[model samples]
Target: MADLKVGSGEDIIITSGLGSCVGVTLYNKSTKIGGMAHVMLPEFPANREQGNPAKYADTALDMLLDKLRKKRVNLNRLEAKMAGGAQMFNFSSSNDKMRIGARNIEAVERILQEKGIPILGAEVGENYGRTMELHNATGKVLIKTVKHDDIVL
Candidate 1:
């Protein structure tokens, strides 16, 4: 796991091996300011509390938004792009309790929608893992899957 940090207008953020995890990249086209959060869970953790709030999906969205706002990047002018939600493991049980990837993807979409951010593109929900890069300067997202190599969006 790379050091997850919020980036400014001229920075680039990247993450790798997004299996059953969601990577959300929020960027402002006008200012080229952005942040990328790799959230493992959809919501806040029950077992632990009161640490780095930016490590969770729900709180990370708010934290990143606040940082961008301070930089004069309006939420309304921002665009979101997501990647990585893979059903990487196969379970023997017939129970429908192991849909972590789908759940994470749903949670990310819902949070972005609630925050009034537009989704420019997304590549999610497959059996393969992905490595993603968010270019802050252009709001251009590049995704590379295990089999497909590199794809630019």
Candidate 2:
């Protein structure tokens, strides 16, 4: 599933159980408004499906950006960091959608570039899961994996 949260420096947004899902964060250093999205799917319908805005990469990014704008955060000052998007399940199928983890990473990166948000760091791709926390106060992303030491990006 996908979800989005936007908050100022006083807040810390967290997302967990990211197997083939990517946890992305966009942060504005000046305003200290951070936005995070737990993206499940790579894309959404062109017409915009009547579903959760945070349920897909396409819609989730848009919604998060809108929220950031509404909060008076300058887009030009924004940067992105991501974690998760692991290839959790192995499959013989070559279908792109089946490679959810990689697809999610690619889609998220593409969207962030389109929005002019530089990707400062990322912890993506592998055969594991991750939990991420975005600290709005310092623009730091804390990524925790079950079998590895904690990573800060």
Candidate 3:
């Protein structure tokens, strides 16, 4: 398992094999600071909520926005980009109700919209998995789908 790394305006953060999940990257151009969160579920676990808040879609977006704000980054200037959210499991399975990936994508979009952030780019929803890379300085997102080529969004 490769580690997801973040950088301040000069480096790129990357994650791979996002199946039935969502990957969110928030970047501050001025400070070149950014972070990426690979969210597996739409909401926080009901039984456990004391650990890292960034592990969840809603809380992670809030936390990322707050960090950028603290660094003097303009909220209106902040742009959002995302990738993943595939239907990885068999629909015939008993766990069909667990559409966590799609739920995660929806949650992320809603959060960004509510915060008034513009979605500059996205590559989400399909049967295939994806590998994503986020560049902090330029807010550029790159996505590589399974058995497919890489794309820069």
- Which candidate should be chosen as best, given lDDT against the real structure? 2
Give the Cα lDDT of each candidate. 0.81, 0.91, 0.75
Model 1, 17: alpha-carbon shift in Å?
Answer: 1.9
What total of clashing residue pairs does each candidate reach?
A: 0, 0, 2
Most TM-score-accurate candidate = 2
**All candidates' TM-scores?**
0.88, 0.95, 0.83
Considering only N, C-alpha and C atoms within 3 Å, which residue pairs clash in candidate 1?
A: none
Clash pairs, model 3 backbone: 8-32, 9-32
Give stretches of model 3 more than 4 Å off: 1-6, 46-49, 93-96
Residue by residue across 1-153, what tens digits does model 3's lDDT show?
A: 112345675677888878877888776666677767777767667899486666678777776677666767767777678888888866665573577677888999998888887777888887789988887777788998758889898
**Residue lDDT tens for model 2, 28-89:** 99888999999998888678658776978988999999999999888899999998889988
RMSD values for the candidates in order, in angstroms, are 2.0, 1.3, 2.7
lDDT of 1 by residue, 1-153 (tens): 322456766678899989888888888777778888887767777888566665567877777778777778777888889898888988887565488788888888998888788888999998999988998877788999868878777
- Which ten residues in a row are the worst by lDDT in model 2? 44-53
